[model samples]
Target: MTTHNTAEMRICDAIWSIGVMLDYTQKIAGFVTPELLDWRPEFPAGDFAFSLGEQLMHITDIRMWIVSQLGTEKHAYERWAGPYPGIDQPWTFRAGSHSEVMEALESSRQLVQPWIERPMGELSLPTAGTVAAWEKALAAMREKGEDTSQLEAKGAGTLGSALFFLLAHENGHRTVTQTMLRMAGAPVERLA
Candidate 1:
């Protein structure tokens, strides 16, 4: 009989969490509008300098970061540029239209889905710098008699933690966007 390890279970849980978040985000995106993007809600005034569209881009950026970390290959971090500080800044992208934002989210999911579905054995633990650096770290850890099994456990912990952070970060932005919609006198329950 084939048995699953703790690491494999954690990876599966992470994938499931991300799937739920993606569905939620996709639904929220349907309610967003160019005008809603422009409105700045006053309840929490002078908080964010960027527009709603920019915040959505930031959410995508965070998602891409998680995606890049799932693999060990070079060019794993590559993603389409958005209107943020740089390609890395998913928060500042200028998504002027609802269609554009939806497309961007869809594109991000497409890039991430394969990685999410990949087996835990095929996925690499987070390593520092280049592959050479990672190898050196592994050697050092081994010399210190660090429990490699525990290291796998720690990595499993990371998968769930990363998913939680990603979901929370996206939901924070979604709250702001929904607030803006309410301020614009548009129905907000449709998003929830």
Candidate 2:
């Protein structure tokens, strides 16, 4: 294979690993109780900042947003459309319980899987032109007081940056969700 194809396969392999990580984290997060998902600690203590429910929803949103950028030049965030929660202020997208959140997360996760294997989700978008997509997503993110420049910096305007952001982001949240899971009185190590 050519260098480009090799790189693509490498990226796909890394992303497929991300799928494994997501499954692990989501399984732990599934233990959160409805009340725990809504419960917030008094202070930000290592991943305890947002209610467990909110954080799960946010992860789902990030997955969806990444898919949106690659799927189209027409981002799904312009007016903050429905069906999926828009990354706007307060993140008012509500999930009735952990099940609801996991359902949405799984749905979005499936959507993004194709993105890792295919060329930018096979939407025929420009490569390296992904910088524009990230910029638009960041602008909308800023309106909601989120800053992702650090992530953009890492990617140097390539889609890999976005892919890495999603993988790392989900991996990072695992600990937080597990902590919440334990706090909610679920066993830390789940059994088969």
Candidate 3:
């Protein structure tokens, strides 16, 4: 297998693992009563502000955004669209259910998997329409002397960056979701 294929496989495994972890976390979250959505912990005392529903939806959005960036010249640091709603924001139109989130994630994974397997040369960084807008945004960031080397080093301008960001972001939220489950009096398992 080529290096690109190897990297894609690793990313695929990571994505699958994150999906499983989200599934398990959602199962535990389901046990929490609706009345406890606003519950907060006593010791260490941090607000468990976002609900389980919100977290799942946030994960779905993150997946979509990452998948959309793949195979495009659009840098991940660039802001393409308006204030996209994330976990902390109100999901006005977006589905916030566990099933809905899973579906979105699965669909995005299906779309992105093929692109991930392609060799680096096969990838094209086209700057057109939304991608062009993204490039403009990135240029502004560069003008400010922002060090985007970390992003570039991790294949930020390609599909690999999408996978890397998704994995890292999911891991961070998984930790938060587990904490929320534990606070809700549900049996939590350490994500392996």
Candidate 4:
């Protein structure tokens, strides 16, 4: 049987510690215009690509996925399969108006709060079926030259890696969204 590690919780706490995600979500609200929310940064084809809008969608979907994956209760492999809702749904994501995306993003961030607070040090990540998913997330960070040594050291098959990946996934997009907004000459001021 696997055990939740107190050390792992400390690491994750620093990642999304109390009020950190809440502050993030609140600050992001009303910071960008509906048009600016639709903005995308200039990047090579397939290179860290995501418009501000797409980033928001990706954040929302991934937040839910991480919460599901990292929940204290273990679930069947089959229960995890299927196309995630709101993913790539431009009508509700990219093409949707700014308010739509903001609403979804805010709700998703809120959904992630309890999971972030829950202790996950003891729970182990499912090794076989889901290892590839987190491996991809870690690979994305590595491609950007981020020091994933600690995360990599976890061997890509533990809850430790999974928690860190979620933090990376959500935090990466949030940072990118802000940068993209700035690049468009929008104020970086906290709006909420």
Best by TM-score: 2
Candidate 3: list runs displaced more than 4 Å: 1-48, 71-98, 115-156
Residue 156 shift from truth in candidate 3, angstroms? 7.6
Off by over 4 Å in 2: 1-10, 14-16, 43-48, 73-98, 119-156, 190-192
lDDT of 4 by residue, 1-192 (tens): 967557556433645453475467447645667767657666665344456667776666676666565554442222211344455432333346677677766776666566455555533545342566567778899899888888777564555565567766666667777777778888786543
Question: Stretches of candidate 1 above 4 Å error?
Answer: 1-17, 42-49, 72-98, 119-158, 190-192
Each model's lDDT = 0.58, 0.63, 0.53, 0.60
Q: Among these predicted structures, which one has the highest lDDT?
A: 2
Candidate 1 local accuracy as lDDT? Answer: 0.58
Our model 3 lands, by Cα RMSD against the true structure, at 7.5
User: How well is each residue in 3-102 modelled by candidate 3, as lDDT tens digits?
Assistant: 4453334433534554465455445445445555445455464423556656655665676666555544332332212365676564343333445444
Clash pairs (backbone) in predicted model 4: 3-122, 4-121, 4-122, 5-121, 5-122, 125-159
Residue 92's lDDT in candidate 1: 36
lDDT of 2: 0.63
Model 4 bad stretches (over 4 Å): 1-22, 42-49, 72-94, 120-159, 189-192
Query: What is the Cα-based TM-score of model 4?
Result: 0.55
